[model samples]
Target: YEFDATVKKVEEAMLSEGFGVQLITGIHDMFKKKLGIDDYPKYTMVLGCKPQLAKRALETSLDMGLIFPCSFTIYEEDGKVKVAHVSIMKIGAEIGLADKEAMAPLIEDTGKQVRRVWDKI
Candidate 1:
């Protein structure tokens, strides 16, 4: 899929997965407006949240809310469109903020959800 199509697909997949489409930021457009640069490749950020899951994470640890919404960055590189996201649960564990054993199920479930979204995109 092209850049626009991929972005739309991601939004639809996320919504179908029961996540709220929070925000879609046009990074390249912002750079053109704020920095007066037109050479940057296309870049956008789509942020989504599964409120219940986020709430559960917070209940486990308030600090977990620091990165409440999950994000997927869509951009062009070497003329190829790319989509990517990071696992917030993994980040929290790696950074020693979340207990690995305690967040095991959440992480697994989140991975499954992400995988579904991936299969769609």
Candidate 2:
């Protein structure tokens, strides 16, 4: 898909999966205009969040906010648009959450929703 199309699809997908797009950063444009580097491929970062899930995680651990507003990167590479996101499960373990079991559902659900967003595109 083209860059704009992919971005639109991703935003729509996130909304359908109960995640709201909090922000989008146009890395390619920023680098080109600010740093005067125009050779970079198109790239954008999408920040999304589900309020209830965020609330639940916060209740479990204030530190969880560090990973709040999950991010997805959409970039053009090899003439194709690709999407990627950090693994919440890995983050949960990395932060050494005291209640992994309690956070498992939120982590898994968030990951699944992200997958759904990818699938939609």
Candidate 3:
């Protein structure tokens, strides 16, 4: 039920945000075929980045490979699908940054985007 609920939330969010949904084969398919991660519904990461954020991030860092923008993955864990979110800013800080102010807004916005994504999930 949790997995189904999360999937539904994501679908509804995409629709509300006017983004298209791309459903790839579930992870179990690969497991049954190769890695043997069977019994779990694993799937490729669901990607949904707002155009505005994408544009801003690109303008901020031509190489802001850090903020490519993606969604938390949904996977079967302990017999349930769990949803999660990761932020580049969070990850970047762990690394090192010279300009914190310039990066602050980007990270803030990223956090907002993540929250919105979670709201849907």
Candidate 4:
């Protein structure tokens, strides 16, 4: 898929899954315009949020905010466009939270929604 088309699809999927795009950072363009390097592949990071989920997580532990606004990276590789994100399960485990029964559902739900966006595009 084309870059812009993929981006649009991702945005739509995120919204449909109850997440809102908080910001989009165009890494490729930044490097080109700032450093005059035009050889990089297209890449952008989508920062997203689901308000209720965020609120609950933060209420549980303020430190959780460090990973708030789940991020997905849209980039081109070998002439194909792909979307990638850190695994929420891994993140939770790393922070010693995934093992907690209460945290499992939230982590799973968030991962499901994020995967839905990737699959949609």
RMSD (CA, Å), candidate 4 to true, equals: 2.1
Which residue pairs overlap in candidate 3's backbone?
27-42
Off by over 4 Å in 1: none
- Candidate 3 residue 56 C-alpha distance from true site, Å: 1.0
lDDT of 3 by residue, 62-113 (tens): 5555645455566777776676667756565445532456667877876775
Compare candidates 1 and 4 on TM-score and give the better one. Answer: 1
What shift in Å separates residue 100 of candidate 3 from its native position after superposition? 3.3
The C-alpha TM-scores of every prediction are: 0.96, 0.86, 0.69, 0.85
lDDT of 1 by residue, 1-121 (tens): 8999989999999999998999999999999999999999999999999987898778767888787689999999999999999999878767777788888888888999999988888
Global lDDT scores for all candidate models: 0.89, 0.81, 0.61, 0.78
TM-score: model 1 vs. ground truth: 0.96
Cα lDDT for residue 106, model 4? 75
TM-score of candidate 2 versus the correct structure, residues matched by position: 0.86
lDDT of candidate 2 at residue 108, scale 0 to 100: 79
Report clash pairs, candidate 2. Answer: none
Q: How well is each residue in 1-121 modelled by candidate 2, as lDDT tens digits?
A: 7898888888888889888899989899999999999999999998988888778788878878776678888999998989887865458656785378877777777677667877886
User: What TM-score does model 4 achieve against the real structure?
Assistant: 0.85
